[model samples]
Target: MAKIEPANGLKSAESRKSLRGTTESLALTDGEGNPFGSDSELNAYTSERQTDKYGFIGGAQQYSEHSAENIPPEVLRQREAKWLDMLNNWDKWMAKRHKKMKLRCQKGIPPSLRGRVWLYLSGGKVKREQHKGKFEELDSQAGDPKWVDVIERDLHRQFPFHEMFVARGGHGQQDLYRVLKAYTLHRPEEGYCQAQAPIAAVLLMHMPAEDAFWGLVQICEKYLPGYYSAGLEAIQLDGEILFALLKRVSPLAHRHLKKHKMDPILYMTEWFMCAFSRTLPWVSVLRVWDMFLCEGVKIIFRVGLVLLKCMLGSQDKLKTCQGQYETMELLKTIDTRYMQEGFLVREILELPVSERDIEKEHLASVRRWKETRGELHCKSLPRMHGAKAIMAAEPPSRQDLRQNPTIIVESPLATKSNGEDKERKKTKEEKNGKKNSSPTPVAAYLEPSEPSPLLKDTALLGSNQSLSSTEHDTYL
Candidate 1:
């Protein structure tokens, strides 16, 4: 049984005695024999002393153990310095490797590094200062009449339905137009070709107008041979190359294409024309462009191979669809970048040069089959005529049509219908004769009139006075 004692706050004579003790037997009592301290207080003091002793010993042991193993201040400082040096060396190594990579010219440079890397890759940086002055000089001169017409016709048509184009009031579109127009003025022989629009749009994604113009010049002159020639012979040759790559990368898919009488020229026309802008969404198109600007023309062939490989698995499903539906479905389902950056690269790097050449020959055989049939040539016509037919069906403004005589004559080609073409031409000639006989001057079309807000705000015109009689005739 536990003993209980009376509580008394008292001190002992020998030294100053505490009221709380570990053992009740050691408690000092007064002459009346009353207990001086309680057993509970004694037990509590014992418990507290035991805890304190254990805590002190534990702390001492921890300190002693840590002191032996812990690093010294000087040693820690040296280790930190050494680690920092290693990190700096790694950074230097990476910088040197990046410089060497630029020289080697293997893959596309990453997007963040595009501007500086492209300048270096194209040797445009060497002539950067000269380009601006040259561009300005070219801009002041009158451009070729054919190119001017082509540029004006396709200006609004470049990215008409794209949200990015519409949101900025076609600023990107205007920049693209200026560069292309300037380049056409600079190089009259190449002039303004159809494929320039898509290429210009891709340039607009990364660069300012001047830089993009020069970058395009590099692509046209150095990277791609004969790109902007009058008959687009260079473009046709590139299509041949892409077809050869597709066959080598995916033979089963290539065989399926031959079975369906599919010509690579049929599907890949947009790919070459727009650099996949019209064929792909904006994001994916930009990724391909990033690679394109870095790696030069080789990336395009690699990317084409990737596109074919992506479609290989789906060829069976695609063949089930009839006619145009199959082609459309195949294009829609294929994952373009994944196949290019992954599967095809792995396969291509492993093949020997002799084997690759043989595969290319096989593809050439398929291309020969397509060429003999005249199928490739037939497929290359502009797809815009279909939409132009819809636009022609809309009620024409009598005032607008009659105001410009040439508009009535040339507008029928927009419909692409044989019956309308002959009828419209005959009518146009008769109308022109009557107008010439009249006493009224042709300058009536050029009379000062308030331009619509849309037209007025556009970057197309330089000044109100620069709008000439020919310009009014063209616009009408």
Candidate 2:
């Protein structure tokens, strides 16, 4: 296990010992922990570590491990030092150096900093502070029998090979239950899904259960709304969007897949649902996640596109795959040995897709799905409430899309790109013999009506906000 350390400095040996003792006390055993539900079927996996080769955990493909051991310690320290400086003055850094941070995330977040960095990226800390003691409260109550029963069966199936979850009723499995169950209570409308278990497991590996719960919230709500709900409307819409984009970017691969009657959901659901955790090699999964959290779901599409290109776009490779079975196998079984970090990440970055592109395509894809289903209401519209619900009611018009800075469709005004705007402004300023003015301040959202307790914890800290109204409105 990674040694736990405070941001300020290392803890004393006594403190470390105390932490270990508490952790051991919390570790679950067959007779030691509370059962999730009345179903005795789950008892089979909880009695001992499951090594079933046919089960979900057993069926999962393992890949070579990647670690910081490959990099120089001194180089890591230098980067960590720079990141630490930014983290120390996070509010200032977020306000002034967001672009720099996004660039850094694209490169990779250091393993040591990933836990905290992910919390920040997903606004987990803010949500955690807001919901102090909520996890414990929800966890203390018995979960709904139906949800608990479903969650119990899948507990041992997640990351069964990992040290954290290998043992029956281990800390990892226990925490995963709390997080997933708390979410069921938190958003009863969505209830639970099997895909959510792996996603929550990934978060728990990074932070405490409470922090992980909120991080999961940001992912399901802010990052991937409508994805874990009934009917999986958003994911189906995304599959169509992926197929459409595939046709535009890799028509040869698209045509081949189409000819075989392959649907995007056939291969892309797990990719989208688990964020590629169960698909990619461990190292590549981490690297992909670093960019995914930074850029949003667009990275998922970009990576999926790259995989399709490799599998079907190349004639030589396509010739080996005779039919849908071979094609599907090749799609799921990615070989990361050839996916060198330097090359694969570069290719993902170089891909022509952007968040704007994905959003625009998503709008059309949802419309297509809704029309086909003939629903009176746009059932594909994400579930929102209060102010957000009001925003979603407004249909996105050409005028609205044109005014938004990020929705980069074929607008004549958008012909002058952001880069062009900067260059043009710079030239004008220089010609007039005036210093270039500071860029316009982004309108910060989520301004609380009262003083947040978070402000009291750190005087320098400011209210963390969502994307600008224009950007947020587009998502709704």
Candidate 3:
């Protein structure tokens, strides 16, 4: 429902009237009624909207590199060069020097190439390639009326201040709707959740609708399993783990939270669900997302913990929080001091929480939760952190793991038995003084070029999938 200007020379009123009947096909057009996949310049219509380097179209107080200190143009150029090298040689780094790749992500990807890097990080690009035409196929179909209605209502609220979704039914909103609707169609059982709108909107700001859809897919399935599903089950489990982690990371914050009996969900739900897209300032949001996509939800936990320590870790900071309401107020208005991109990213990197530690705590949390309830709404645990982990958990990777290596037997059992008998007969004939007239016999043996099912060992429990000699590369 973007405010379409008449100067653009396009009639949106008719499109609006037909939307009810053509909602399924709406993904086929841009805001100006451009062809579906034409991808007409997304932000060409900025006009007089005051935008930032990040394409934020508003006059509001935005926090970014300017708010603190700017990265010098020279250094940014060097980093961009290095990023280009890493991207071109992505397979080399991912296979051998992955630690270096991770270190590069912590420094932050250049905004110009963030969407491509994000596609690499979240495994979305690969997923799209693996399952071609799936997003379009889903987009072509009408979404479930129950979920589509809710999705349409929430479209305008995704980033009302941002240029993309500023117009109610602009191209941005149209793309956002397509991505979310495709997801619902892609995953009918999961249906939809309100948190997904902002998340999808954030992705649309970077990538096209199709890539954004796959990015959302990776987020839901590989990055944060069961997060947007029924019962809010996975997120609740993570909430408990976050509190438990808080006890160790910041004991004072833990004591303060416990004193107020504050549950993590009351505050951290949006933070986790939206991946802090809604909470942090724009650049800070991007900075955190750069790490979040690279490091997984632990970065999110680290961000939450870092903020908690800064807000209520000290005696003086705790004195103001006399009750739950004050504590909530403190958490809601994240002071700009703590939101500075540089400081927050550094703190997150140094946080002592490791994936092993989180996994340990996760298992403990799940065990405790089951003590009270015999079953969890969603039994799927969160996948391990990082893009490598994302690809490793994939079916192709598992299929490789499940493969039984080919074992060739070169023994001459079939040929050797006949040859040994012939030699014995020849020795017997020589002892009996009989003249030998036959040619010398030699044993021959070879492995078959193709494996015959008859020669296969039927008792072994394994998959028939063959293993590839070439390693799976993390490149386009």
Best by TM-score: 3
Question: In order, how many clashes per candidate?
Answer: 0, 0, 6
lDDT of each: 0.45, 0.62, 0.69
Give Cα distance to truth, residue 29, candidate 3, Å: 28
lDDT, candidate 1, residue 205?
Answer: 55
**Model 1 pairs whose backbones collide:** none
* Cα lDDT tens digits for candidate 2, 314-360: 78888978887788777755665435466568878989997677878
Judging by TM-score, tell me the better candidate of 1 and 3. 3
TM-score of each: 0.49, 0.67, 0.72
Tens digits of per-residue lDDT for model 1, 1-476: 01112111111221011111111122233343222234464345445433221121111111223122234656554443432232223223223543444332333333333443454344343344444488667667777776767676555444433322322234655676678888887666567665676677655555556656776776666555455555444455556666565566677767666666665555555565555655543434544555455444554565566666666535565556455447545654455344333344444334332324533553575477466643332122221111112123332233322221211122222334544555676678788873323322221112112121122332222221112211122121
Candidate 2 has what TM-score?
0.67
Worst 10-residue stretch by lDDT in candidate 3? 467-476
What digit string (tens of lDDT, one per residue) describes model 3 on residues 382-471?
Answer: 576977787567633322222122233333564576677778988999999996688644423222222222333322122111111111
**Candidate 3: where is the Cα deviation over 4 Å?**
1-49, 59-68, 395-476
Q: What is the descending TM-score order?
A: 3, 2, 1
